[model samples]
Target: MYESFYGFTSKPFQLNPDPSFYYGSRGHRRAMAYLEYGLHQSEGFIVITGDVGAGKTTLVRSLLQRLDSSKVVAAHLVSTQIDADDILRLVAAAFGLPAKNVEKADLLLQLETFLVKLTAAGKRALLIVDEAQNLTPRAVEELRMLSNFQLEDHALLQSFLVGQPEFRQTMQSEHMQQLRQRVIASYHLGPLDLAETRAYVEHRLGCVGWKGDPRIEASAFDVIHAASGGIPRRINTLCDRVLLAGFLSEKHGLTASDVDNVVTEMREESGPERSVTPINAMPGLDSSALARLMADPAAARRLAEVAAGYQASRLEARVEQLEKVICALLGLGANTTDGADQDKERRHAG
Candidate 1:
């Protein structure tokens, strides 16, 4: 709905991880270097850990985009809750190999043969597994065995394991010691800083061809940065929703108040207390917790403002309704250029 108004070619803040929209902030740059170094070395497992909404997947996608396909064979996999055998099968399937009903020995042999072929062709094979925190101890051990497949000088196959911070905790387990030993490179992708957070939002908007008077106000970014803690996914969600709020009000430029509404709305929907929860009541909070919460006066005001308007009986329902409306509007905005006609089918049906 706001795409043309904003002069964007597409929705700038869509949650989907698109490499084209990736903003290589300092932390992201370091993470990308870690991934690139791992690939360049043709080493064993390279592990990347970050919080849920951090840009690990985006970093991976960026690396894939720049990789020389002619000399690099890459496979990506998600949904990694399987057993050891299933893990190998999934890996094989990623490489377009028939994995069904294949025994472990046969699967290894097939993979080895494939690796040898790639090596002979002067190409490196890379396997990327996302959400690997779910992998069991045995599954990790099984993955470690793949590192054994190497020529005299270099590894024949490399694996990149990307997962949430819990995966790092998992790796620290005694059972994973051997696998950790085999890891040639690893990085913890951290959140963007305040400046980078602002730049990130602008970069994503620009990627989608935004050329209008910037819909997002400068003051709004401080609230966004505070609310989202510089997490890319959360930023996208909040920014996208704020745009909807602005559009609904027919505002050309977003204000801090617009961003406040979105952040407050998010908090109400995400938890019982729309404002600050007591320090002891919250888990995983440290000594700086209270200080951090109070540090951003604007964010505090936004949270308080939202909490003030939220009635216990109607909060959840209202939040859900707003979320649906916002999403529908965003979907309409996204469809304007590429698939506008296809979206018309729904209107025709209605």
Candidate 2:
């Protein structure tokens, strides 16, 4: 909604990780450098640990974007507390192989064959496992074993492990000694600092063609960093809500107070359970009416159309304002030229 009002081509503060919007803060840059070093070695495990919402996934996406698909075959998996055998199957599936009901031996054989084929085609295989903290010791061991697969002296498969900070603790366990031995590079991604936080917000907004509409005050940035603790996802959530608030209030500039209001509202909504009725639970909203809306396809379509129409109207208003400003400036220039011409004529007559 605010995207149109702010003249953005796309939603900049979206939650999903998009490689195109990656911001290379100090920590992220060091992480990327370690990842690049891992790629150059082309063997062993590269462990990247970070706090929740520290942009680990975004960093991985950015790395994948820079890779040459023809030379690199990459597979990604988010761990689900699966056992060792299940993890092997998941890896096989990530590589586009059928793993259903396959025996453990067969799964390993299939994976080896696939990796060998990729190697023969002059492509290296990169396996990225996210949420590694959820993986049991056995599952992690399976990954370590897979890293042992090689052709002659060159390793066929390289693994990159990404997870929350607890994963670093997991790696220190006695059971993880072998896996630790295979790690060639490791880095801990940290939250953005104050300066980086400001840069990060500007970078994302700039990506969507933000031209300072709903201009944000410097103090607002400080408030956002304080509220979000410099976490990328938290910052996105706060900024998105703040922008919505600005739109509703018809504000062309945002202050720290705007951010504080939104943060307070969000906290209240997420606070402890209360006896009072929820604000969204309108008195007239009957169960039947809600069920009908949910069941009816046409109702959903109409709701979408209504939303689109509202956004279109907002964009139209903004465009009209811009046009008016441009025309006024042009008229002023014309008046100045006419005044100069009149003065010249008076001088000639004299």
Candidate 3:
């Protein structure tokens, strides 16, 4: 809603998965490297785990988009809660084989033939199951069985299991010893740091053709970092709401005060402790202390620049404290000016 007002060609904070907005934080880049390596080596099973909204899906989407078409056949399965037999049918359907009403034996034969054909044609097949945590024991077992399809010396079909953190727990279960052993490579996507959070915001904005320096107060950015814990989806949600609030008030830039209001509103709507900004107010920390940095354009710019270069966790902590103090001082200045204005108004009325 605030796109035009902010001079953006498209929405900067969309929830949809877009590779253009993918920020390669250390964890993300490492995961992608693992994915790329797995694809090249024809690894048996690649497992990727992360917390909810940690961009697992986005990473997978980006990986698939870069797959070598001439040498690899990639099939993505987003539904994983089906029974073992249905899992077979889903895999069959993904490769354009006869799946509906087909017997298990018939489906397996068809799949094996397809894999053999792909191998003969100088290509390999990839089966990517997203949300694998939702898969039942039977389904996971079936997936393990499917991994058995191999040539004399090489695996024909490579499988990737990607899901939220629970998927890791599921894999680590004693019952899944076989499956766990089969995972040739695995990675857990971690949260982006504060510097990454800033770049993440800017990268998404740039992707949507935002050329103007859309002002988000420094204090507001810190609130976003703390609230979102540097998760992309949470950042997007807060930003979208913040932009809407700006639009409703006919403003072009977002102030620290605006972010404070949005954070409070989010806390009230959602449960008090949820990390993801609630669709409604959830309990959120006050970020008004960052306002002073935002009031001065140069200082805000310098803070952003310094944050970009800051790589140590300890140093970041110190800088964050300094930023808060500056904001508090600025707040005091504003309060004093406001008090002076009120005194003048009282004298005139008297």
Candidate 4:
């Protein structure tokens, strides 16, 4: 909404993980290096774990964007607490193979056949499992077994596991010894520092063609870094709202005070106190008016209706985003095709 006001070509602070806007902060660079090292080794598990909004997914997307499709075929899956059997099926489905209602043995056979075919075609198969923290021990074991698929001395498939910080602890457990032994590389992604935070914001802004029209004050960067705890997603949320607040107030430059106000409003919106209010307790409502509304059954019904509508709107938006992610994971969208083709197009356009 504020794009035109700021002369941006697109929304700079979107929460979605877009590879084009990826910023290689210090920690991200090391993580990427580990991932590249894992790819070079090409026959074991590569694990990356981070906090909820530390940009793990974006890092993976950036790696995928740079891959040479002629040499590698990649499949991505987002875990949802699936069991061991379901994990196999999900992996099969990720590679565009039919998996529904298939027996475990059949699913494994199909996946193996597919991987072998890719290997024959001179391409290695890569499986990226995001949100791996939700996977059951049995499910993870199934993944390890898949990694054991080999033609002679060559491994047919490689796996990259990405998840929240707890997944690292999960990997350290006694039950995960076999999986641990197979891990060739692992990196813990940390949040950006203050300087990286400033760079990150500027990087995203620059991607959308920002030319300093809506200038962000130096103090504002500190305020954002503190409020967002240097987490990329949190910073995106805070900055997006701050920009919107600036646009609403017709201010071309953002100050720390603007960020503080937006943060307060966000907290108030999410706070329990905002969820319900008695008619008499509502601010700016006179005692007599409150009494009149409390006495009128129609007024109470209208208020309930309004509240229900608001809740429904919020649910609808959440559902929409979930649907988009599901479609992307399933490769059901045109934009979700093989990364190689998209990368080629992106480079050609550039």
Candidate 5:
């Protein structure tokens, strides 16, 4: 709705990861370099860990977008908490190989055959496992086993493991020593700094043709960066709503006050406090325990992941309601556009 009002060619702050919006902050640049280095080596695993919403998937997508199809065939798999057996099937399916009902032995053979064919064609196979934290040790071990595929002294497959930060703990455990030994490169993507946050917002807007209309004040970016903690996805979420507020008020510019009001309204409506009474009490989260949980990195990442999943489930419902309201407002706007419709139609009919 705001896109039309703002004369934007696209929704600049969409949640979906788009390579076109990839901003090269210092950390992201380093992470990208590590991924590229892994590509050049063409073997083993490359591990990338980041906090939730720190833009790992966006980084992966950007890499995929730049890949030369003639040299690399990449398969992306978003994992859940599956086991060793299921992980094999998921990998097979990701590469477009039939994985149904086949025994583990056949599955391994099939995958090896496919990889060998790709190697023969002068293209190496790249498997990108996203949400790697959800994998069981055995599942991750199975992934490591796949890296053993070789022909004529050349490895047939390479893997990239991308996940929330806790996955680093899992990867460093005793049982994972072999996998760790195989890692050629690894990087942790950190959130953007305040300065980069400001640039990121403008960069996204510029991508969709923003030309100073509905100008965001310098102070507004301060509010945004603080609210988002310099996380890209959170920044996108808040900026999207801030722009909506501007569009609703028909304002030519947005200032810190405008941003603050939207942030306040959003907290009241959607913050975890809305369910805290039940979440903290009925669900058995005492104050001390809650604090401890938040302090623990693994627990915090799990909570955030679960909360994000719950929020995503509600997105479709929200989109439907928003669309209905927008359509209604559009009909009303059409009627009121020029004094309840032009009289030219009636004159022409007469």
Candidate 6:
């Protein structure tokens, strides 16, 4: 909603990771270097671990954007809790091979043949397993066994494992010795610092052609960094809210106190499911303007006029109801008089 107000061509703070808006912080650069190095080596496992929303998937997306699909047939898999045997089927399916209703031996043979064909054609197979922390030890071991596929001393498939921090613990298991020995590179992604947080926000805004219509004060960035703890996702969430608040208020620029008000409103909204601005939000007036409007003489008089109009409507309705009651009472009295007059005329005739 605020995107239009800010004249942005696109939403700058969306939660979905878009490699187009990928910002290279210090840590991300190092992690990307490792991933690139792994791609070059074309063997063994490349493990990447990070907290949720720490740009892990963004890194992968960025890498894929730069990949040479002619030489490498890449398959991306989001890991599930399937068993050892099922993992092989999943891998096959990812590479466009038939996985359903096929026997395990046949499935393995088909995958091996596909890889061998790719190798003979002067191509390689690359697999990226996402959310790999969910994989059981047996499932992981199966991945390692697939790495054993060899074509004349050259590995057939190279795998990249991306998961949350818990995957590191999974790799530490004693049963994982064989897999550990085969790991070519591993890196843990961390959150941005305050300086990087500011840079990231600006980078995303710049992506959408930000011209500073709603100029953000420097102190506002500080508030955002502190509230979001320098996490990319959290910063996105808070900054999006702040922009909306500013747009609703018709603000040309935002201040630190404005950010604080938005933060407090977010906290207060925990009670009920509420929207930032009500559906009937009006131009030149917003929720935050109530106090100021009440203080100003002109605005106060306008409000008083509105209140007076409402009271006048109620009074007019009451008067109309009283008039109807009076008419009903007058009609009953006339009917009684007519009945008496008729009875007297009958007596005289008798």
Candidate 6: tens digits of C-alpha lDDT, residues 164-219: 99999999999999999999999998767656777999999999999987898866
lDDT of 5 at 82: 83
Model 1: ten consecutive residues of lowest lDDT: 276-285
lDDT of each: 0.73, 0.77, 0.74, 0.77, 0.77, 0.75
Give TM-scores for every candidate, taking all chains together and pairing residue i with residue i.
0.77, 0.77, 0.78, 0.76, 0.77, 0.75
Q: Whose TM-score is greatest here?
A: 3
- For candidate 3, the per-residue lDDT at 164 reads 86
**Candidate 3 collision pairs:** 265-281, 266-281, 266-282, 267-281, 267-282, 268-281, 268-282, 269-280, 269-281, 270-281
**Candidate 3 or 5, higher lDDT?**
5
CA error at residue 239 for candidate 3, angstroms: 0.6
| Winner of 1 and 4 under TM-score | 1
Better model by TM-score: candidate 5 vs candidate 6:
5
Clashing pairs in 2: none
Off by over 4 Å in 1: 273-350
> By TM-score, how accurate is candidate 6?
0.75
How displaced is residue 61 in candidate 6, in Å? 1.1
Using alpha carbons, what is the TM-score of model 1? 0.77
State the lDDT of candidate 1 residue by residue for 130-210, as single tens digits.
898988878878888987997667688888999999889889998888888889888898766666778898888878877
Tens-place lDDT digits, model 2, residues 1-350: 88888899999999999999999998999999998888888999999999878899999999999999999999989897878869999999999999999999999999999999999999999999988989988999999999999899999999999999999888999988888899999899876766687899999999999999979987677556655656788789888888999989989999867887887677567553311111112222233433333233344223222221222225334323322333343334766445545644665587
Stretches of candidate 3 exceeding 4 Å from the true structure? 271-350
lDDT string, candidate 3, 37-146, tens digits: 88877957999998778899999989888888898899999974677868999988988887989999999999999998999899999999998889887899898998
**CA shift of 18, model 3, Å:** 1.9
